[model samples]
Every structure is written in structure tokens, then in C-alpha cells.
Target: MRKHMFFSWAVLTGLLLVAIGCSDVSEPTTPTYETNLSSDEIKNSAFKSEFPLHYETYLRNDESEIMTEYGGSVNHNKNDGVNPLPEGYKYAQPYLKNLWLGYPFSYEYRRARGHTYALKDILEIDRINRFSEKAGLPSTCWNCKGTKMLEWTDEYGDSFWVKDFNEFREDVDLDENTIGCANCHDPKDMELRLYSVPLKAHLESEGKNFSELPRNEQRALVCGQCHVEYYFQDEKFGAAKKPIFPWAKGKDPEDMYEYYKNTGDTNIPGFEGNFVDWVHPVSKTPMLKAQHPEYEMWYNGSHGAAGVGCSDCHMPYVRLDGKKKISNHHWTSPLKDPDMKACRQCHTDKTPEYLRERVISSQEKVWNQLLIAQDLSVKAHEAIRMASEYTGPKPFNYDELMIEAREMCRKGQFFWDLISAENSAGFHNPTKSLDTLASSQQYSQKAIDKAVEAASFTTARDLAGDIREIVPPILEHSRELQMDPDHMASHKWFEYIPLLPESEKVWEGNERLTSENAH
Candidate 1:
């Protein structure tokens, strides 16, 4: 009976795909609303005066990071957009390239930029272009980049996920679609409303619903829409694309590890366990990439325990003109603000200098350990590669041992990502950050130990000694890893001018394009 039911569903899915292919109507093929409210009605209900729906307006009026060089946050002096790295941020791309050599991230993954650069950066990234001429990427890439996503979701429905990313690039108006005020703003009153499909679905599976949550919880939920880790679950389905959050068990880094370890195939409803994002080329282990999980980190930290929302620290309210006050929507580090006023609001006893040092101290500690984790992880990969490739006598089969090593790498990288991928540099929850890093260190060392044990099975016993010797030199093997040391030296592709000329510069490299559709 179960087999028959699945067969029936497969047949229905096939029929639906056939209908989609045969139709000439390529525009959004789905209903826009679940209720009687039209788009205008929904807008009218949420906003009164015209809400500045475009983010460019805000960029022009107030938050001109390009114009002010993020108010000297970029490089300790006001200059331009081409170099936006904050003070003390060192280039880690060469290290990451070794870590993710088998994955597309190795092609290009820079430190994240402000919200305004979201769409432009993604469009310009080399990872997306590696196969853009052929397979390209899935539409899921557009999920957080722009406000056009909301419109595309309403128009295409489930079809949105299944379509090639290039399809939307060709079909939609990219310029007007960049993420803007309309995304989180309610058109009627400008109150925040959740629009993330994955967040809504994940919450439902966890036995909670977004709409029913209190205003405060909703604040966190709003951030969770894009900040949480997720994976594409229905890739094999071909016709249905689903981005699922593996939060059935919980949101902790360990909880997510367990969820990914035990969750089965998409055959199961609501839970995707034992998923594989990509198999590591060098480690040969099935791996999962951790997205920026600020929400999850904050959830496990002191602030969250104290019921402090993300906005309390990252987005603080400020008074201007001595009378009018509003929540600062610039969304940057509170410590970087001119006076450290946000921290003062909470810790009135601390001076701005002390608070700056406090945050920087925590970040430096995590950053240093993160590099150690990177070094150890790279060794784990080399160890596995040596063990598997050893051609000396007794051609040992270390399949099980390799599996063990991969699991360690899995946990190790996950923990590293918990700190490294997270937007906050450990300041959000210093204790949790350190604890997570300790786990990464432990897991990484275990992986190295397991790899050594496996390599000992080599027919030439001396090969085991050599494998041990080989592991220590992995960090210095950058040339062998095919990673270029000069990866961070160039930012020539970046455009720094804000609001003037009304459009940003074109990429101008191979297929160089602008955030707007024009060349």
C-alpha cells in the first residue's frame, strides 16, 4: 500500500511538471495570497505614508557606507568601497581555499559586506560564475539577496525553487528587485513581518508558528529568516526545490550535527536526516557547510538567555535632533558606533574604550583559535589522503577508519563554522564561542589520531611514519593545494561610489555585470 501511494504521488508530480513545460505562460504561475487581501490591500493595511520601499533611498539619505567608507570602519580611515575590511581583519581566503578545495566556495568566498552589497556581491562572486554558462545555480541563491524574491515567490510558488537561477535572472527586473525596505517592512504600518518560507516551515515542524509568536520572538524570527543554516533538500526531485532548516531536534550546533547525522532521505516528511551537502574532495567525507548562524549562536548565548533580542545590541535605537528618536536600521557593530552608546545603554558602568577592547579581545581570541582549527582540519584532510593513496605493501583498506576521520572533520568544521561563519566575532556570546572552539579543537585532533591509526596499516610500515611526518607540513602545502596566495590582493572589481550616477559600476571582468541589469 505504501509503495502504491508513492507511485501515485510520483505520477502526480510528473503530470505537474509536464503541465509546466507545455504552458506558454512563463510569468508567476501561482496565486499571490492565501486570503482575500490583494497586494495593494496588504500594503495599505501595513503602511500609511509612503514607505521608502527601495533601500537606495536610505543609502542616499543616511547610510552611505561607500560615501563615508562606513564612517572609517573599513580600514581605520575614510577612503572607498573597494576595501571594506574592518580594522584587524586579516585575509583568510588562502586558508579557506585549502579547506574547501573540492567545493565551489574555494573559488571565491570573501568576508561578507553590508546589506546594500548583498545582491551585487552574490552576482559578482566567482563561485556563481564557475558554472554559470551551463548548469548555473539554483534560484535558492536569490533567497536573501533582494526584495524581488517576495514577488518571485508569489508569482512562481514552488516552481521558483525548481527553476535554474538563470531563469529568474532572465525573467525578473534585477535592478528594482535588490533587497530593500519592502522586504521586512509591512507596507501599511512598516511593522516587521516574516516572509521566509524556510523559517516558517521550520518553525511549523518545531511545533511553533511565526504569526502566532509574540512581538519580541518575532524580532528574532525576522533575523532567522536568512541568518540560520539551511540546505537544499529536494534537489533530486528536480521539479520541487525546497530549502529546509534541520531544526527538528534543535538549533544548537551539536543538535544540527545530530540532525544531519540521523536524518534520512527526502522520502520522510518534515525531516531530512543524514543529508550530504558535498563530499570533501580531500577528506572524502560527506560534509555540510554552515551558513552564517548568528541567530543560532545568539540563541545559545548569554544575551538570548537574558531575553535580549538581536536588535538590542546590533540594531539600537538612537535619538537625533534631541527630540526625534528611531531605531537605527544601519545594522552594524554597536561597538563601532561613534560613542558606543548602545553598550552604554545596557552597561552604563563601562567606558567606550573598555567596551571596544572587550569586544576586540573576545574576537581576537576566537580568531586565533579559528586558525588553529583550520590548520588541524587541513591536516586531517592530508592524513586521510595519505592513508587512502598509500600504495606500499599490504594495500590496506581503511574504509571504516576513514569514516571515523571524516566524522571528526565534520564536527570540527561545524564547530569552527559556529564561530567563523557567524557574523558576530564571539562578542555575541563569548563563553559559547570559546566552548564551541574547544569542541572544534578536540574533534580535529581526534581526526588526526584516527587518520594516523588507519595509515599504520600500509604494507611498508615505514609509510606510516612518513604519513605521520606528512601531516605536519599540510599548512605549508599551499602550492600543492593549488591555492593562490594573492587571492586577497585585488579588489579592483568593486565599485565605491554611492547614489551618484544612480547605478553601481559594472564588474567588467569576464562577463562583468552590474547589480542592475545594464552592462
Candidate 2:
């Protein structure tokens, strides 16, 4: 009987080995970035080795592994607790195409993924690579990607901003670097330090020195280095476009808008002048694209006001090898923690499942309303196009009407982008998010009404007829806009939760649970 059992086990083991040998497990799907030249490959091949204490092997390739493990089979939405998107569902809002028309983002924009993917994803985007001769990207674009930025800044100083993106792409083999240990750590002690020059300068301009801040505040400020909204201003440092944060006025959505509108009145010395990121093709309004302002948004929230730093939630300490406790370097959404250790640290009353439901419920409310704002903005653009060509009678002067509608467009887009671009869906501060989305919807609707009213003077009724439902035929429209022909065809969403399905299907909360949370 013992011999028979041993033989059976041996045969099973043999079959498993054969199956493993035949599988593609030996070949990893992710590109192998190994360089042929070990020490001789790049000039600063061992640059990080110079500060051995500061550098650690931080690249965990955690996106696939973690998403598969904690996030549920690689297709689950980390925050919302939803599985992969269903058929015919698009991860990107189709209205975004209309909103960003005449801009590179209109060609392609995907939801952000892990820190490890930052450089690779940017390099692969169609928005930056539509043209052959020059990639539609500036060197300043690399600011948030990785730790090697310090070396590049030391070498080029301010001239780095003007250099074409490809210049650095060719010179620096990006496969070797990421937002690693060196980015936030000091070389000697591994203590936190802010390396972003723009952030340091901006803080100084406000008479609030970053280094003088308390350690807890500094932790979040390190993240603020890249997470805040900034614009590239010409001739501030050199001819190169230097990134200037609009913090002299304030950090709120309204404050940033006012600062952008009246740049000459800025309290930040030496940056007093009007700035324009891009002119909206449809509305002709000079638009501001609010980058992920997570720092700014959180700062205005209750938690941040209570001195909770970003690391508190996102980089909670985890025990490694069951002995050494260290902050998790795989910076990602805290919701992916199956153990709910991070959330439970603060919210002792709630379970992981409850927290997940609360998050999805809050986000769903904001997102559904956001889509309305988007649709309104699209219609506003169509109305503006009609009003521009109209030789109509004037209740308000044509140019004045155009200016008014454009102002609405500007304000609407600003509010919408603030909420939309922020990494956290409304969970950071539900009240603030809802309020901002409300303003966005109000402004968007006003823009549409203003545009339609102006277009009424035109003799051609068909021109302004049914401006509603005019989502730009973006798939076909890109061809007319001179974008890459194959961009839409080649568009790819992340494997995890690629397309958010209907709320009922993706979200798993009952009415009783919803009622319980409402209180």
C-alpha cells in the first residue's frame, strides 16, 4: 500500500513538471530591459551605487502580481472592488475626446496605473508619438516619472525643459529607472527629502520654506512635488518653459482659476503675467489642464487638516519576512489591501467590505454627474461653432457673447478637470467632490444655454439645431485633425478593470447596506 501511494505521487509530480516545461512561464510578457553593456552601457551605470545606502531594489513589478493577488484576478478595480469591465464598455469617457479636441490628449488618454509603469506608459502613449519628426512631448514631461530626474536636472539645469522628449529618451535608457528609493530618500540616512526644484521654489515664494516644515507635513510635501497643478511658463528661468505652481493666490479650484485668469496680479514675485497652456479649438477659450492635484485637494480635506500625511494611507507599514517592518514601496490605492490593515488603522468600526462599498458609492455619484458635465460641455462647443458663423441679430454683441460662453467653458472645464484628474474618486472628501461636480454641471449648462442664445440670430436654424448629443465623432474625427491614423484602432486599456460597466453590475451593495452607510 505504501509503494502504490509513493508511485502515484511520483507520477503526479512528473506530470506537473511536464506541464510547467511546456508553458510560457519561462518567458515573461513584460519587455526585458537588460542592456548589453553592463558597466559600460550608460555613462552613469553605477550612479545610484555612489549612494548605496540611499538606493534599494525598489522595482517590484508589482502591477501584475499585486493586482492579480489582492485586487482579484488581475481584472479587478482596485478602489471600487469591481471586476474587469464588461463587453462594449469603454474605460475612457467618450466625451473626453470632445473636451480635449485640438489637444494631444484628445488622441489618447488612459487611467493611470502603478508607479513602475509611469515612464514606460508615457513613452508608449499615442498623444506623444503621433508625429514622426518630433514627439509632441516636452522634456518637462519626465518630471514625475522616476529618480534619474535628479541626475538630468544636475546636468542640464533649466535647459532640460526645452530639449525634445526623445533627446532624454535616447540618452537615458529608462528601463533601468523608476520612482525608486532615491526619489524621496536622502543618500546618507534614507530620511525623506524633496528633490523637485520647482516645488522648493514655489514654497519659498509663499514665504513657507519646505525644509522648515514639520516632518509629518514634509512627508506629504514630497508627494506634492509632482502631484500639484503646475504650468510651464516661458522665460522665467531661461527660454525654456519653467514649471510654476499657481499657489500665490491659493490651492483651491477657484483660487487656481482666478490665478490663471489674472496672472499679472499673482503675488508670486517675477511670475506676474498672463499665461495660456492652450487655446480651446471649439470655444477659443485659453484652457488650463489641471494635472493630478491630489496634494492640493487632500490639503483642503479634513484628514489633511488633521495632519494626516499621504504616506499614512497609501504607504502604510507592512512587515517583511515576518521581522522587518517597512513602509510599502509599491505606492498604490489603499483599497487593494485585502487585510484592510490601513483602513482599519483609522476606521476601527468598519470592515474592508464596508469601506470598499462606501468608496464605490461615493465615486459612482460623482462620476455619473461628471458625465452630464461632459455632455453639456460638448454641446456648448457645438453651439459656439454655430454662433461664430452666425450673421445673427444681437441681444448681446457677437464677440461679447462669444467671450461670455468661452468664460463659462473655461470655468466649467476647470472644475470638471479638478475632480476628474484627481486620483481619488470622491473618497478623499465626498462633500468637496460633490460640490465641485455641482459647480461643473452648473457652469457647463450655462455655457450651452449662452451659446444657443447667441446662435439664435443666425438665419440657418439647422446650424445650431440639436447641439445636444454632439459627442465628437472622435474615432473618425482624429483623421481630420491630423492625429495618428491607427491611434483609435491601437488604443489599449489596462488589463485590470479596462472598462467600467454599469453601476449595478460592477458595484455589489444592497439597499440595506446603502441605508446603513447613509447615516
| Total clashing pairs for each candidate | 12, 1
Positional deviation of 512 in candidate 1, in angstroms?
A: 8.7
RMSD of 1: 18.0
In model 2, residue pairs whose N, Cα or C atoms come closer than 3 Å (at least 3 residues apart or on different chains), thus clashing, are: 392-457
Q: Highest TM-score: give the candidate number.
A: 2
lDDT of each: 0.61, 0.63
TM-score, structure 2 vs. true? 0.74
Model 1 bad stretches (over 4 Å)? 1-57, 60-93, 170-175, 235-240, 264-273, 393-397, 457-519
Alpha-carbon shift of residue 303 in model 2 (angstroms): 1.8
- TM-score each candidate: 0.73, 0.74
Q: Give per-residue CA lDDT, model 1, range 198-295, as digits (tens).
A: 88777776798666787778888787888888877644533355677878778877888887766445332222356766667666666777888888
